[model samples]
Target: PFFLYLPHTAVHLPLVPGKNFKGSSKGGAYGDWVQEIDWSMGELFKAIKAEGIDEHTLVLFTSDNGSAREKQGSNLPLRGRKGRTDEGGMRVPCIVRWPGRVPAGSSSRALTCTMDLLPTVAAISGGKVSKTPLIDGKNIWPILSGKSKDHPREAFFYYQMDQLQAIRSGDWKLFVAMDSKKRNWGNPEGKKALALYNLAKDIHEDNNLAAENPGIVKQLLAHAENAREDLGDVGRPGKGQRKAGWVKKASPRLLSR
Candidate 1:
């Protein structure tokens, strides 16, 4: 009956750890911070066991994005960093555990996003999400329950700001611009070059197959176009862009300092 959302503020900027853990880790400060995060999770699990509800709780652990380049975090065997549409930027680790309900130590390679959390939680609580406005998330409860072996998600669209940069369908990923190397967080410009890779074979995205797979490229392009129709891209403006309701701000009053 209780829902506790814990958002930890570790492994981020101003990365300082307690004195006891400062020089204990091999990777220096960031490693110490990571150690603290692990210890914190262990303590949380201990507390849950103490409450005698460990088997009844569903625990999901994940990060918002991939490792940051400046944080000494490694996203090895994957291309690009945080702020890019590459696998290393979009793909993140996800772990879910429910003692009796979910199978222990089972892993799925299915594509899932943080947006899916809203619908997943709603499905678990037997609540209905609003249909007046469209929701981009799909119910992944079936996958979590092991009732379904396949994921409902078929495609993933990558974007920087309002620009659509890449699309992944099946094991194939296509990037419209090959120039997302540097992290320009707010830049609206997308690279003009095109690139493609089969993630199953090239998780590092070292090989470009766009030239050999024209049919696949066309199919993934259609997926990107479909997304643009609903959520118009800044790089290529479309007619289907939804406008946000304007919020009026209060007028500023002049006061003597």
Candidate 2:
């Protein structure tokens, strides 16, 4: 576990460097900060090579969450920023390098996520999952091994501040922002609704397809029920009605029908 996750403040704080990496990245205050993180990887990898533990190890690297625009950091092309229910906040980058066990110089669009990390680790280490609550994770060993080209997860979900309940099923994603896009205030709309997108064609989620494809919408909705419980973000449970109030009581209008 070449795992390195520390609260790189300044992006979240007042003024404080670790006194180690004074100047690193190309950016500036924030650039030095982010680059220190990247540079730490270089250092850790160097240590691994020196110890000769790298070949037998699987080094996985990823950001804790998203970057802060308040600090001049950029997610670029991804809408919204950190601490929001938007893609920019939730979307993250990950890289796993295992010399012999994992294929080199290839990429797999496995639709994997942080939620699946536990099961993946369990699978790799031959360990047991604690059966803990809100474990909506599955082992992505096959996908990572380049065996299956298709993603094991039928849907990818987003729960912002435990308020918004969103799901990306196949190419289409449905966002249920509890807070109104209208920004009318009032403890944020504890409502039920959805925003759809075909991620295959529109990874940016610039379009909505809920009205166009009701069948997929329904399937994902049902999936949302289980996912919510398994994910259980913000101390919110999965039972009862959806938190979003926009699309309440509306069944999907399948294109097949």
Candidate 3:
């Protein structure tokens, strides 16, 4: 009968932990912050158990974006950090717990994003998803309910501001736009260059297989073009882009009182 959305700000910038947890982690302030978040999650789970509806409740936890590189945090083995269109900047951690429905101690490598939440929640709550307009989410209930192992999402497009930076199709991620921060971020040569990586094999994204795999590059580029045409990215204007639902403000008319 209730839905709770709890957004935590613990692991972000200004990594300051409580006095009790100051010296708890080997990762310094960031480590301490991470531990504190774990503690908070434990408390949340305890409260769910206390409510007596733990069995019926479904909980999902995930980050909005990848870890921040501006702060001294580690999105280790992930090529780029926050603000760039790389796995480290977009690929984040997600955990879902639905007792009796979702299998326990199970994990899937399905490609999913935050956008999928809207449709997934609608499917779970028996809501009309067709009424929702201008949505990119797909219901992942099958993947969650143990009915299917494959996800319906074909590709995920990465955008920083209005720019379409990258797209990941299957296990390969291709970069159409360059990372502007590549110079200071450590790879000057890769700045604004076309890059590609097989994420399954190169988790760190050290290898740029774009030159070697022209066919795969072309395929992913097609996917990107389709997304651009639908979403209207920086250089390309989309014909299929949905109109924004902005309400016009009406001017007040002067009346004799």
Q: Of the candidates shown, which would achieve the greatest TM-score relative to the real structure?
A: 1
TM-score of 2: 0.75
Candidate lDDT scores, in order, read 0.82, 0.68, 0.81
Off by over 4 Å in 2: 1-24, 132-134, 177-193, 227-257
In candidate 2, position 227 carries an lDDT of: 70
With a 3 Å backbone cut-off (N, CA, C), the pairs that clash in candidate 3 are none
By the lDDT metric, which is better: model 2 or model 3?
3
Candidate 1, 1-257: lDDT as tens digits:
88988888877778888787898788878889888888889998999999999998888999987778856588887887887777888899988989878877777777778899988999899898898576788888788888877757778888777778889887899987544433456544544578899998999998999999999999999998898887877656656555778759878789998
Top-lDDT candidate index: 1
lDDT of 2 by residue, 1-257 (tens): 44444444554554344566555556666666666677667987899899888888777776666775656678767776776555777777778888887789878756778778788888888787776444667888787777777877777776654543687766667875343432212345455457777766776667877888888878887877777665464456756334455875888876873
Per-candidate TM-scores read 0.88, 0.75, 0.85
Report each candidate's C-alpha RMSD, comma-separated, in the order given.
3.9, 11.9, 5.7
- lDDT string for model 3 (1-257, tens) is 78888898887777889898998988888889888888999998999899898998999989976777635676888867776667887788888998999998888888888888988998889885775365788888898887887857788888766677788888998888555533224544445778898988998888999999999999999998888888877667787666668659978788997
Report the number of backbone clashes for model 2.
8
